[model samples]
Target: MLEINLNPFTELQTDRLILRQVRESDAPEILFLRSDDAVMKYLDREKMESLNEARQLIQDALISVKKNEGIMWAICLRGTDFLIGTIGHWRFDKAHHRSEIGYTIRPAFWGQGLMSEAMQAVLDYGFNQLHLHSVEANVNPNNQASIKLLEKHGFVKEAHFKENYYFRGRFLDSAIYSLLKPKR
Candidate 1:
C-alpha cells in the first residue's frame, strides 16, 4: 500500500478575513451555501441535501490538500465563528509554476467585497508562498460579477469557450482568465 502524506493545514489572516482549513463543525454553514441555488448555479454540484453530505465534501477537500491534489481554504470573518465561503487552488502544475483558483461566498456576503479581500490574500500567497508564476480562474461568461472581480486582480482573459459547461440543464460559456507574476 502506498502511504499518502498530508500537508499540515494552517490558518491565515488578513485585515478582514480569516482563511483556514474547513472543520467538521463548519459543515452546517457550508451546507447552507451549498444548498443555495443562487450560489450553486455556477458550481458543479447542484445542492447538498444534508450535513453529512457537506461533511463528506469537507473530508474529501482536506484529503485532496494533503495529497497535493488541491489546496482548499475556508473563508471566515475575523473574530466570527461563521464561515462565509471557500477559496482554493486546484489544477496545479508545479513544473509549469501555475495553478487555478476557485472561490464562492455566501449570498448574504455578496456586494460586501469580502470575497475580493480573501481572494487577494490567497492570490498573494499563491504567488509568494507557493512560488507560483501564474494563476487562473475560469468563470462562466455570464457571471459578470466574477469576471469583474478577477479583472480587478490583473487576470486577463486568455480564452472564451462557448457552451462549455452544462449547468442547470443549459450549456454555458466560460471565460478563462489568467494572471502572471508582475515583472520585477
Candidate 2:
C-alpha cells in the first residue's frame, strides 16, 4: 500500500471550479446547503438547524483530512470563494486502495455539468495522486441524476440493496456504483 499523505496540498482547480479545504467562513453557505430540504432529501444526515452545526461539520472535516481518514473539499467557482457545493472521499480502506465518494451541489447548479467536471478532477486525484485502485458511490435508487452522473464517469452499478439504509423513520433502498483504476 502507498504511504498516503494526509496533509498533502489542499487546493484543486478545474476549468471553472476550485475545490479547497472547508473553512469557518463557509459556515453560512454550508448551513444553506445542508439546511435546504431539496438538497437534504436523499442525504442520510439530518439537516443543519444552525450555523453552529455547520461550523462543527467543517471542523470535523478538517480533522478527518488531517488524520488521513477522509478528504472533503468546498467546491467554489474559480476566482470566487463562495461555496456552491462540496465533494469528498470518505470510508477509505487503505489496505484495499479504495474509498467512497460523496458530493452535493446547489440546486441552482443542477443540470449544468459542473458536478461532472468536479468529479473528474477528484477521481483523477484519487486514482493518480492517491494511488487508489477503486472508488465507489452510494445513491438512492430513485436519484436518476446521480445515477447518470456516476455512469458518465465510467462507474458501473455493483450492487442494489433493498431498504439497506434506515433514515428518518423510513427505509431507503441504495444503489452502489464503482469505478476501477483504468488499465495502463
Model 2, 1-184: lDDT tens digits are 6556769656889999999999999999999999998888878788889999999999999989888888888999999999999999889988899999999999999999999999999999999889999999999888889999999999999999999899879888999999999998
Best by TM-score: 2
Q: Can you write out model 1's per-residue Cα lDDT over 1-184, one digit (the tens) per residue?
A: 2122226765678898899998899999889888998898766657889999999989989888778777888899999868889998888877788889999899889998988899888888787677788899988787888989999999999999988788779887888999998777
Per-residue error (Å), model 1, residue 48:
1.7
What range of 10 consecutive residues in model 1 has the weakest lDDT sum? 1-10
Q: Each prediction's TM-score against the native?
A: 0.90, 0.96
